[model samples]
Target: MRDLLKISARYGLIGSALIIIMFLVFYFSDENPLQELQMFDLFIIPIFVFFGVKEFRDRYNGELLKYWEGMTTGTIIALLIAGITALFLYLFVGWIDTSLLPEHIEILLGNLEETRDKIVEEMGADSYIESYEKVKGTTLRDIVIDSFAKKIIIGFLITSVVAVVLKRKELKPKS
Candidate 1:
């Protein structure tokens, strides 16, 4: 557990820093931070999850990693990464630049319009519009929840796959 915490903390910091750097890249560029393509940047979390578990096996566990050990390490990495992301989100929206969020929400609404049109056409005007309005009204708190919730959920799935791949049982000698 001690090794897991130490390894996860370091990897989690790297994952979180990458997210913030990605945000800054978008925030500075002409591109909208809320752009759908930015979802690709989320690949960092899984990468770190794999690294954390792998390091635990290689550096501390004597080249033997049980399925549960890898899974737990991955989970710890996810939790730490998600928490750091949420904290940075609060800072980004609440302090670093509050105005960026309103603009981001506007972009979110603009992008949603085309999808909303299709949804309305398929389902009904009123139902889609109502949901669209709700989405457009999203607050910074909502963004915080959304950003962390998305990472945590996806992180768990990635951790599961990584754990399965990385798990290696110890070989025992016949007595």
Candidate 2:
């Protein structure tokens, strides 16, 4: 448990560093948030999964145990990394651009409103539009929670399959 905690913290720290580097480069170069975060996310998965597999292989023998260990480790690491990344972004945005929150909120609401409006138009339903309008103010906390929850689900889903493939074991022939 101690070792697992240590490993988890270490990965979080490493992930924080990666986030800083990626975001800094993006910010300095005036990259769009979607382009930067999306690209960064795409790049991080393989690296995280590699570490996940290596950690599990170091501790376990059976394939099932290896799979569980890898998936668990990956999921925990992903969550820690996400929390750390969010903290970094929160701090950076607070420091560099306080307007970021409003900008993002506006963008989100606009996108959601547009999508819901289109759906309502297609179905000729007033209820769907009314439902979206009920939430007049969307907070950053809500966005973060939704994003984090999605990341947790996605991380577990992807890692579970990778864990099976990356399991290290030898099979004996039937006699």
Candidate 3:
């Protein structure tokens, strides 16, 4: 267990740092921080988790990995990355540049309006109004929670597939 956490922490910090750097780059470049480019996280989490689990199996576990071990390692890394990124987002939007929250909300609302017809047709007028209100009332706390939740959910799904692909059992030697 100690080895699990140690390796996970090391890789987790690296992943988190990379994500934070990406956010900074987006922010400084005047690009919308909540843009579709954020999807890059889908790739980042899996890569780091894969390497982290692989390291544990190769360096510490005699080249054998269990599904649960891989899952646990990936989960821990995900938690660290998600928690740190969410905190950074909270600070950046809540304190660093308060204007960003409102700007993001406006952008979301504008996009929502652009797709009003489609949303209404698919979900009905009530659903469309609910979505509009939800976007309009979004807060920094909501953003942080949303970001954290998304990372965790995506991380778990990716970890599931990774664990399956990497899981191995110890082979028995001839008696």
> Largest lDDT belongs to which candidate?
3
lDDT of 2 by residue, 13-113 (tens): 68657866887787778753523474566567557755755664565333333566677667777787677766666666666766656666666567767
Candidate 2: lDDT of 82?
A: 73
Pairing residues by index, what is the TM-score of model 3?
0.94
Query: Regarding lDDT, does 1 or 2 come out ahead?
Result: 1
Residue-by-residue lDDT tens digits, candidate 3, 1-175: 8999999999889999998888888889997676643697888988998899999988988888999999999999999989998999889888888888888888889999999999999999999999999889888898889889988988899888888898989889989
Q: Which ranking of candidates, highest TM-score first?
A: 3, 1, 2
lDDT of 2: 0.63
Q: What lDDT does each candidate get? A: 0.80, 0.63, 0.88
lDDT of 1: 0.80
Candidate 1: the clashing residue pairs are none
User: Can you give the lDDT of residue 28 in candidate 1?
Assistant: 84
Error of 3 at 161 (Å): 1.6
Q: Of models 1 and 3, which has the larger lDDT?
A: 3
Question: Which run of 10 residues does model 1 get worst, by summed lDDT?
Answer: 32-41
TM-score, one value per model:
0.90, 0.70, 0.94
lDDT of 1 by residue, 80-104 (tens): 8788878887886689787867788
RMSD of each: 1.9, 4.0, 1.3
